[model samples]
Target: MRTKVSKGKMAKLLSVVDRTWRAAGFKIVQARPKLPSLSAAAPDGCIVKFSVGGFGQVRFDAGVGAISPGRGFHVEGEEGDTFPKAPNGGPDYTPDVQDRYWSK
Candidate 1:
């Protein structure tokens, strides 16, 4: 079974993604909370979109190539917790998929 990510957690994740993309040199075209999409434009004028998948997974789409999550992308509990929480709010058993994407 899959669990949905909470709104607060989703916001945090999106913020992280925004920072990561900016650090990777992508310009943020727009990032609106009301909208379900976060759009960024590449240096070459290509627009990339990041959206929340129906199952609460992070999805990435780049016009040129396939994008996948990079290293160190995992969701953990509140700041004080030392371990990640499962979507079911139990022990984390979910496989780690790339949550952040960067161009090489």
Candidate 2:
């Protein structure tokens, strides 16, 4: 998926996601553009993909006004297969955009 956000913006967002998620105690594994038919919402914007041990894979959709506002942060795919039970017992669809520095 091609995003309208610039590469610089994407890089910055990735750094922020890496730092934030790492600070959250999750091992910052890796990040990618799209998970390839994984996300429930195909948001072609700034997305941060990562793998936290025991949590499988996760993606953060940064609502940087690309395409639509954004899908915030969420995880699709089967739990234990593609992802695990989300943190805070939250649903797969989480509004993490409000919980990050990007909200500023």
Top candidate, metric TM-score: 1
Q: Model 1 over residues 1-104: C-alpha lDDT tens digits?
A: 12344554677667887888889889999887654568898786677887876545556677854345666555575354343687788776332444232200
Q: What are the per-model C-alpha RMSD values against the true structure?
A: 11.9, 16.7
Each model's C-alpha lDDT? Answer: 0.64, 0.38
- Report the lDDT tens digits of candidate 2 across residue range 1-104: 11223323445655565667556555533445442211221133334343221222234343234455768565675243222247776444322223233333
Residue ranges of candidate 2 with Cα displaced over 4 Å: 1-4, 31-104
TM-score of 2: 0.29
Q: At residue 37, give the lDDT of candidate 1.
A: 61
TM-score of each: 0.49, 0.29
